[model samples]
Target: MSFDIRPAVPPDAAAACEVLRRSITECCVQDHQNDPDILAAWLGNKHPAMVASWFESPTNYSLVAVRGDDIVGVSLLTGAGKLALCYLLPEAQRQGAGSALLRRLERQAIELGMKTLYLHSTATAEGFFAAHGYRRDGNVRSPYGVETILFWKPLAEGAEPESKRKRFCNCNSA
Candidate 1:
C-alpha cells in the first residue's frame, strides 16, 4: 500500500503515539521478547502527551505516514541530528512507508545543515538502517534490556567518512 508522508501536527499525537506503542509491542518482538517488564519500561513514556510535546518542540521535526485516514507510521528528528523515533505499525512493515519516512527525515536534516544523522536501531531495524547507508558505530544495551545498534549516516556530499581515513590490515595477509 502507498503512504502519504507529511509533517505531523498536534492533532496527530494520539494516532502517532498509537503507532509507536503498537509497533514496539507487536513488531519488535525480537527486541522486547514479550517480556512484560521490558515492554513496560520501553513504553513508559510513549504517550500522546509526550508525542504532542515532541511535535511542538522547535528543535524537533516530526512526520507521520498516512494511508487514507489512518496513520501507519511516525518519525522524529532532533536538531542535534538524532533520528530520535521512527516507528510503523506491524501491518505497515515492508511496504516502503518506513523507507519513505526515513528518506524524508534525511533530506530535512541535510536541508537544515546537519552533517550526520544518528540513531540507535533495534535488532529488528538494524538491517533496514544498514541498507539505507547507515554505518555501524557500536552497540549499547538499553535500560529495557535490548542491545541496540548505533548507526550513523553522513548527509553531506563528498564528505570523507571516518572508516575510509583509517584501515587496519594484517601483515601476514599479503
Candidate 2:
C-alpha cells in the first residue's frame, strides 16, 4: 500500500500513540528484549494525552505516515533540530514510510534554518540513519536504560564541517 506523509494533528494522537507503542514493542525486540521493567519505563509516557500534547506543542513539528485510513508511522522534530521521535509500525518497516518521514522532516528543518539534525537512535535504526547520511557521534544510555546511538546529519552544504562538529564519548558512565 502507498503511504503519505503529512503533518500530525491533535486528533491523530491516539493513532500515533498506537503506532509508537506497537513499533517499539514488536519491532524493537533487540532493544527491549522483553524485559518487563524496561518496557514499562520506556512506554510509561506514551499515552494519547501525552502524544496529543506533543502534537500541539508550538516547539514541536510532528508528522504521521498514513496508508489510507491507518497511521503507519509517526515522527516529530523539535525547533532546535532534534529529531525527537521516529517510529513505524512493524508492517511499515522497510516499506519507505520511515525514509519518507525522515526526508520530510529534514526538509522542514532546513526550511526552519536549522544547520544540523540530531537524534538518539535505537540499535535497530543505526544502520538506517547511517545510510541516510547521519554520522555516529557517540552512544548514550537512555532514561529507560537502553544504550542508544547518537547520530547527526548536516542539513545543508557549508552547514557544519565534520572536523568542527563536536564528538563525544559514550555517556553511559556517570
Candidate 3:
C-alpha cells in the first residue's frame, strides 16, 4: 500500500496513541508472556501523560505513516539519539512501514548531529533490530516485568561530512 510519511502534528496525537496501544496489546502481548496487568501498565497506565507530551515536544521528533487517512505507524526519536518508541499496526508489519519510520528517525538523529542511536527492543523485535544492524547490549528490566534487550548502532564517520548532510548510515541496510 502507498503511504505518506510526514512529521506528526498535534492532531495526530490520538491516532499515534491508539496505534501504540493496539500494537503493544496485539503484537507484543506474547512477548509480555500474556500478562494483562503488565500489558496494561506498559501500554496504558505507566506513562500515558508522558507519551502524549512527547508528541508536543519540540525536541522530540515524531513521525506518522499514513495510508490515505489512516495512521498505520508512528515513531518517536528524542534529541539524545534514543529511539523512544516505534509502533505499527499489525496490518502494516513487514510492508516497509517500520523500516521507513526508522530510517526517518535515523535521518533526524543525524541532522541533530548525533553519532549513535539506541533502543530497547522487545523480545519479538530483537531479531528485527539485529537484522537491521543494531547490536544487542544486554537486557533491561522494565516496570512491567518485561525485560527488553538494548540495541545500538553507531554512525560511520566520513559517510557524510558533518556540515552538509542531514542523514547518516548506521550500517543497517546501507
Candidate 4:
C-alpha cells in the first residue's frame, strides 16, 4: 500500500505512539518469546509522555507514515542524528512504509547537517538495518532484558561532514 511520509504534528503524537506501541508489542516482542507482560510494560509505560515530548522538542525530529488517515509507521531522530525509534504496524511491514519513513528521516538528518545516523536494533530488526547499510557496532542490553545490536551508517557522501556532527553513544566519531 502507498503511504505519505511527513513531519509529525502535535495532534499526531497519539497516533504515532499507538503505532510505536503496536509495532513493539506485536513485532519486536515476538522475538522475546511472546512475553505479554514485558510487551505491556514496554509499550504501556511512559511512552505517551516521552513521545509527546519528542514531538514537541526542537532538537528531536519525528515523522509519521500515513495511509489516508491512519498512521502506519513512526520514527524519531535526535539532534545528533541518533535514530531513537522506528516502528511500523505489523500490517504495514514490508510495504515500503518503514523504508519510506527511514528515507524521510535520513533526508532530515542530512538537512540538519548530520553525518551519521544510529539505532539500537532488536534481533528481528538487526538484519533489516544491516541490509540498509547499518553495520553492527556491538550488542547492548535494553532495560527490559532484551539484547539489541547497535548499528550505524554514515549518510551518502556530500550529504554532511562527519567532523561537524556529534558522536552517538559508543559509536566511533571518526
TM-score of each candidate structure, all chains considered together = 0.89, 0.91, 0.85, 0.84
Candidate 4 residue 147 Cα shift, in angstroms, is 0.1
Candidate 4's residue-wise lDDT over 1-174, tens digit each?
Answer: 889999887788778878877787778754567786666545554356667777888888888899998999888888866888788989999999888888888888888877788787889888779888887777776666567787778886643334433323321110
Decide which is better by lDDT, 2 or 3: 2
lDDT of each: 0.84, 0.85, 0.75, 0.75
- Model 3 weakest 10-residue run by lDDT: 165-174
Off by over 4 Å in 3: 45-50, 158-174
For candidate 1, give the lDDT: 0.84
Relative to the unseen true structure, what is the Cα RMSD of model 3?
7.2
Cα TM-score of candidate 4: 0.84
The total number of steric clashes, by the backbone 3 Å criterion, in model 4 comes to 0
Where is model 2 more than 4 Å wrong at Cα?
161-174
lDDT of 3 by residue, 135-173 (tens): 777677765678787778776663322233222222111
- Deviating ranges (above 4 Å) for candidate 1: 158-174
C-alpha lDDT (0 to 100) for residue 114 of candidate 2: 91
Q: List the residue pairs that clash in candidate 3.
A: none
lDDT of 3: 0.75
What is the clash count for each candidate, in the order shown? 0, 0, 0, 0
Q: Which of the numbered candidates is closest to the native, going by highest lDDT?
A: 2
In the range 1-174, model 1's lDDT, one tens digit per residue, is 889999999999999989989999998999999999989978888888888888998989999999999999999998767788889999999999999999999999999988887777899999999999999877767766778887889898765344432122111110
